[model samples]
Target: MAEFEAERRMPAEAEQVFAIVGDLDRLSEWMPTPIGVRQTGDGEVHADVDSRDVHADGLVGVRPEQLRLEWGSEDSPDYAGWLQVEHAEPGHSSVVMHLSFLGDQPEARRHGSAAGEVRQWLDDALAQLERVVAGTS
Candidate 1:
């Protein structure tokens, strides 16, 4: 399995950050991949994923108390991830996103270049999240 993590500091409180990050339905606002999400059940959703004309079933667990969100693809066990919001310096919050690519994928995707791409994706997603938190996006 390959794991990657990205973090950013937001100009907001932890609760304020979590309010945006913890919303499963609004994933498209910051996720950079999924275009839309519909809740299928408690902690479960169907997402219009990426450019693929495919709707993927996903599990999303939101913990307001901990300011954390966990998600994974139910259709493909190869993908799983979590997002966490924590208190930083006063008037600031730290957000971290972690992704685990499990099992087999194409050769190119398992290489160093793919790792860079994944990191870029994560960075872009976090930048979008910052915009969301700031009410700019």
Candidate 2:
């Protein structure tokens, strides 16, 4: 399996970041490319590539100090990962996103490049989120 992980410190509270990531509809706002995601069930989400629907399974784990999401898409050979938030203080938190994909196909390799691009996108999005939440933007 190929893996990619990134972490960032956010000024917002953990709950705030957790809420943003948990809301499937908000993915297009932070993801590198515009993605259409809809809740398929209580904890499952379906993503659309442009307009073609892609299936994915998700699980949410909530704790007193953290929130985590484990997800995997059907199109990927073995793509699976988790996004997590750990509260460090009342107004500060850490966000970690981990993604893994398995395969060696040309298309799979191309899609793998998304790991880096997506990480940068999340960094930008988190910055914007911090500004918006702080009402400085």
Candidate 3:
């Protein structure tokens, strides 16, 4: 499997940062990926890649005790990831996001210009998270 991870230190406590991460409805506000995530009345979560592409049904697991959130595609199990929040210091915390590509073409997508794009996307996501944590976004 091919994997990518990004960590960022936030100016708030672990619980504070995790409160934002744990919200399922506000995902697109901070996360650059997975636009238009919505949960149906029957409790099934769905997300669209774009307005024109196919929608993916998914599962989301939230663990408040561990300050972690796990999500993956149920329709296409080739990718899965989790977000973790840890206490860094007094009144400060660090958040880590990880993505794993379990498809056959993982290695190819992890190299060359594709790798750079992925890295930038991860960083950009964290930057947005930072803004949200700081109450600026």
Candidate 4:
């Protein structure tokens, strides 16, 4: 398995940040990709993502301060990932995201490209969130 992680500090309060990440349906508004998410059951979601080069069915898992997903295209092995929120201070929060693809996919693990992609995705997503929260977007 491979791993990618990124962190962003938001001016918004922890509760507010948590509220945003907790609702799966709001992902399209702040996530980097134009993705639509739907909850299928407990700890499960389906993502209709349009921005990435590949398309896949995503399974979601959620906790009070964390969200996770497992995804794979029809012909490829699955990838798994999670987003976590941590309260850093009053009216401040941090987001951490981690992603990993199956071990056998050489392309997925080579040159840390997968990790870089995920980091960039999270960076953009958080910037958007900051804009929205700060009433600048």
Which model scores highest in lDDT? 1
Candidate 2 per-residue lDDT, tens place, 7-38, comes to 87877788877777777665555654445556
TM-scores for every candidate against the unseen true structure:
0.83, 0.66, 0.83, 0.71
The window of 10 residues in a row where model 4 has the poorest summed lDDT is 65-74
Task: Please provide, for model 1 over 64-134, each residue's C-alpha lDDT reduced to its tens digit, 9 standing for 90 to 100.
Answer: 99999999888998888899999999888999999888867531254676677677778988999998888
lDDT of each: 0.81, 0.62, 0.78, 0.63
Can you list the residue pairs that collide in candidate 3?
none
In candidate 2, which residue pairs clash?
none
**Relative to the unseen true structure, what is the Cα RMSD of model 3?**
2.9
Candidate 1 residue runs with Cα over 4 Å from true position? 33-38, 51-55, 107-113
Worst 10 residues of 1 by lDDT: 105-114
Candidates 2 and 3, the one with greater lDDT? 3
What is the lDDT ranking, best to worst?
1, 3, 4, 2
lDDT of 3 by residue, 17-80 (tens): 8898787777777866635777642335787756236488888888999999898888778878
The backbone clash count of each candidate, in order, is: 0, 0, 0, 0
lDDT of 4 by residue, 52-122 (tens): 54445555555653433334343444566667777788777777776666667533563666456556776
Question: How high a TM-score does candidate 3 get?
Answer: 0.83
Better of 1 and 4 by TM-score: 1
| Selected candidate, larger lDDT, 2 vs 4 | 4
